[model samples]
Target: MVAEEAEVLVVGAGLAGLRCAGVVAAAGRDVRVWEAGDEVGGRIRTDVVDGFRCDRGFQVLNPAYPELARSVDIANLRLQHFGAGVGVRREDDAVILAHPLRRPTRVPGMLAKRAVRPSDVVALVRWAYPALRPSALTANTGGDTTLLAALDDAGLRGELRRVVDRFLAGVLLDDGGSTSNAFALLLVRMFALGVPALPAAGMQALPRQLAGRLGDRVSTTRRVVEVSRDSAGWRVTAEDGAVARARHVVVATDTRAAAALAGTDPVPTHGVVTDWWASDREWPGPPMLFVDGRSGSRGPVVNTAVISAAAPTYAPAGRHLVQASALWGPGRPEPAETQMRAHAAEILGVDAGGWQPVIRHVVRDALPAQPPPLRTRRPNRAGAGLWVCGDHRDTASIQGALVSGRRTGAAVLRALG
Candidate 1:
């Protein structure tokens, strides 16, 4: 078969690959992208199950992502925002700790329940205030430590501390608090600045919009089996014997695949299992995330939410969508169906046994591990004409993926010139 030719070739049509293609294409370069999956959106995919839109895993699109404005139309996605608060399940009842600015009405209740103590508030501010600065995420100038140590050092061993820990477990997929404190604080800053939301269509809408920008440049189901350097730059061989030759190649696949194709060390990863359920009963709770905050209680389910309450489009008329997530990886056995339901029931203060199970997504590589000594910019160039980009190369978030893709694209352009 005749080999395809392009000035730049991007493997994997995830947010990173698609964004890189956009950058190169915008620069008048002939760029092409190949995706191994049957459709775009890589890890950020959604499936319709009995009229419910079940995303591969629990995820949210934060409008505060700085790169989002430069890449996709957030307004066009018609985002349905979650309430600026989190419901914490205690031993007796569920309480909420809300954003002070956005949910001022909830503040009085939070204070009444002692969910936000003065000491805890001061400690949290001391720990996370630096990340609110513009240069905190862009430059790694601060001292680094595990999240636990940072919180403890800042004297945040209160009820609010437990709430932050449980909430971050669902977001970072790291229940151990071993992730970099800086990275975690940066995420908190983003959450404070912008409300996390779901598009009316689904989380996949984000990547779908990016893929649509590239038109036919993205070819799905063309899994590249190998990437090798050639006299002309590099060659990518797909599983079905199709070949693509390019002057520059970017391995923008997931962490494991990128490591294999680019011959780089595979970074550690964390996984999460998310189960979606459909219920006939209306959601009785607010449209926000619910976390297990029973003091020192490490339940099987980290977090869960009445997803349809926040975004009605996720469910069909008269039905509701709910999702529960648990940390899944080494030493962390997947929770049993009974345990997941029980924990979710406790968190939401609702009977979950009658909810119909829609689907369970075991995203084993949900996110690349973000360890301490946060290095926002890892080397993207693997060799002369070889490069790599993904959340693995930067922070483990949508913002990281898009920024890494754009950064790699510019590097390739400079090299080509």
Candidate 2:
């Protein structure tokens, strides 16, 4: 109703803020969402530049996220699924790891690769078979170890280890593969459910759908810079002098931003650089993520793939869009543009000179590092009248952001009662 007083105010129009606001509004509360940027989705942005749809950072939506149903409209997104599995590029040949159930016909092709020896295939089956059972999950109690340590203890070595290593490195963004086992298991469960995909319109479609449902409740281009309490309830003032008062304020910003607002320490993070390219030719076959068999040491690009092949909207008519990504720690120099292009060509066995550069995004705080002693969900309540939710407070992924938002929404509802 465009009232200055909202029962609940959400400071961030990204996934977390939108999801929380959606839940609050559905609960019959008047909630307002304020965003600093003109566009929603935060890091999950997609821009059409020179006929190429460039996603700000490399991201994928795991339809298997438990909280996904609560936040996003699955069927409405029109997701474009990636191929059943990934392709690992060895020296001369590419090894395909097709999901046995989804692509039964591709089983023979996967087995033909030298990397997938008979024993490795059996080991993969032994691991994958029982994992399908939800009951197979072991409780995440106190002690935890790195993913590399777990793989080694399980006796995964050589080509099999390298294949899994490269794949996890790409997905986890753990350059040294040191993320905690519990968190990695959570990710494994999500990945095992089905192939990840992009929205037919772009990644923005997910948040767009959430915001569309919110309608005019969201105020874009209004930055909520300060949250203070007077004798009244609470007041949130934007840098532009715009103000809104609410009983409760949810700070669904990034870890750093949230920490800055709350005067707390920011969560440690890992940086990632994604380079976008457009080419006249499409990549070889079905849409698949290509990972380096040599464990990222051979090149700056740990993985490269044609996103347009998986989601046609990523490129204009007859053009192809490719993405290559590398991860680094904070304060480290990002991989240069030339290094990324050359490394991508080396990994994909393509001509780097031909593909034109679309854009390069070096995100210093791309993801929260999931080191040992990990807690899947951090605190959602910043204080009695304030709250926070984002990847920083959750599992450090789009799924985490959604889940945290939904959780905080419930908390706010309970507080109101």
Candidate 3:
């Protein structure tokens, strides 16, 4: 029996689902969004503790994504900007190297560390010049090679290579050696060209803003248990025995969930764990990212930062919010809470022994594996009137999620017309 009819039904009210629904709704079509959880924003969630806003895991928004402006309100996000460079701790020394364009003053610091020698600087310019061409920056130079091989082809070695490998180990949550060269290059381009920021309230502000536009149209606690084709077009059933029928149904859930609901093989993914703590240390310079070169760090933390530096609102009036993260796999070391703080201290040379540990989040399917030969835009249509869209269908970032939504929405629109 048909429970209700919708012009378009979006399963999962994450960024992808919200984006797809927003697009269809803007065209004056009836759209409904069903979210299983008590709230929207999926992995992008923020918790308010004792008047301080702490994100579940450390994440940033990149303004360099071309699709962002078309999908969401830029000014309303009220983003908080992070410094344009990374601080590397190699052995006993700690040094910073900012992007020349973003932190001209810190260029000398990059040079001081020899992260990029004078000749390497010229090569770097040659490497980055193509980003000026909008088409060149947007186009994908297809490749099925590993990122390490791409670095070799680009002639990026020495300190540049060292820091990049170290940095990406944290970002990609892998050794950075096995990632797709094409995807890695795209990520590099985004990093070099984009401004990283966080929403004033927290990362959740982004999805919450999008969900607010739908008002009552987005329903939480309605877990979609099954997806099937019907005479009407498609049928999505909730665990509670309710149903939503529509001419087109988009499964915008995560890769694993989507695969399960669609009866497809689950994709490989990377698990990540992060711990947040409160510290009372002196200023650690700018709100820049800190990476461990693995030159002899004594802990599992590969990257850490006082995120409150990037966004003052993240912490209450005078408290500093610290976050540390690492990629997880077999043989991975997960030190206890105290050890994590000590490890962070060893990397930053800050004594965090007195800092208070607040929260720790572990996501088993945090990021979908992006191997070489990536199809940035995967086919969204599962069958007639059935579709799927998520970060797994594209690059593993907010850009990918929104882009998938846009593409799915466009495909649905063309089909209906």
Candidate 4:
């Protein structure tokens, strides 16, 4: 095998790449990362406007993100927790799903409301049991079933579907049919850990902090044009004709980008558009809401949240920030902004006509459509010295991305040793 120069080279500067770079660099290996964009953080993007901090889309840190918490010093960041009760808006009436932290005994009362049917409550109880049981819930077993399939009764299925769709709009980013039951259960488990929290500065703070830690080891705007293997290692050609040979190469971009770079037959992946808004009014409460089972004039709008509403730092004093996201299925037609605004106003009670959202951004490929078995995923190790890491390769979420990156880094370190 032709020997390569550097110990490791990581592609993409998203969460996965950052984690991989941090690990390999800390291990004293010669690690370098190439990012296509001018900045890192990949999909975990945040923007600040008019004193309001808005994320590319609404993002919540699962207090249960084990690898993320361990890898980074998140406690030092300005983080705030969600309110004890999460509101569910359906047919314009708000139903509260109170967390255990707020009112321990009132959970039963909240569950008994008309918004959540008795059957739905029973299904929740059954589902919660396995999660509560030790050894049943773990990383590997998280995405095993679809949320709809887990419930035995039709009534329970319908109720929970509405509750989840309307309240936790962005939770799955998939239609009811496509969402995994196990993943939904895992989200419920996150609720037990702590309501979703946000960093004081913004979501981008997390990635910026990670990049800062890596220092000069990371490079930006260096698009990797092609990746080919040599006898000993791999050869990575940049768009500018610059070449880098490495003992190991980690592809940590999204599945689509990774497939493109690796020359694999691209698979069909769904795309989404996320719009962020900054408002002057203080959000009535925390921004975590579920918008399920509501009939909209423009068909079904999946999930919506007020990110800045969840914490004071997200927006300037007396102002709040909101992110409304719509997941378009593969081949699904894109809805107009007017349609989205109308739906958001109707479901979220935000006066779309009156409120002028200060900052707006859209993501074409928000996340891959997560189907059961996640067959389109590529293994972390692709070839002799080429490795892959991304949320799509494992569970499709922030935690999954971190885990994949850490595992790939470990594997490369071992192979080099």
Best by lDDT: 1
List, residue by residue over 1-417, the lDDT tens digit for candidate 1. 999999999999999999998999999999999999999998999999888999998999999999999999989999999989788888888887886545557666866867678777778778877776747554653677899898889998767888888899899999788999888888888887899999999999999999998999989999999998878778899999999999899999988898889998889999999888889997777999999888766568989999999999999999999899999999989988778878898889998867988999999999999988888889999998899999999899999999999999999889979
Off by over 4 Å in 2: 1-3, 100-109, 122-138
lDDT of each: 0.89, 0.80, 0.79, 0.70
lDDT of candidate 1 at residue 344, scale 0 to 100: 90
Give the per-residue lDDT digits (tens) of candidate 3, residues 240-337.
Answer: 88898989889999888898887655678887788898777655667888877544345777688888888889888778888888777656655677
| lDDT head-to-head 2 vs 4, winner | 2
Candidate 4: tens digits of C-alpha lDDT, residues 170-286: 666666555655555566666776667888887888888888988988888989988888776788888866788988889888777888777544434545676666667655655
Off by over 4 Å in 4: 1-5, 99-104, 111-115, 134-144, 152-160, 166-169, 263-268, 290-300, 374-378
Q: Please report, as a residue range, the 10-residue window in candidate 1 with the lowest summed lDDT.
A: 134-143
The lowest-lDDT stretch of 10 consecutive residues in candidate 4 is: 134-143
- Candidate 1 shows a clash count of 0
Please give the lDDT score for candidate 2. Answer: 0.80
- What order do candidates take by lDDT, descending? 1, 2, 3, 4
RMSD of each: 1.5, 2.5, 2.4, 3.5
As a whole number from 0 to 100, the lDDT of residue 28 in candidate 4 is: 89
Per-residue accuracy of model 2 over 120-183 as CA lDDT, tens digit each:
6665555445345534333443556787776766666667778777778878887677887667
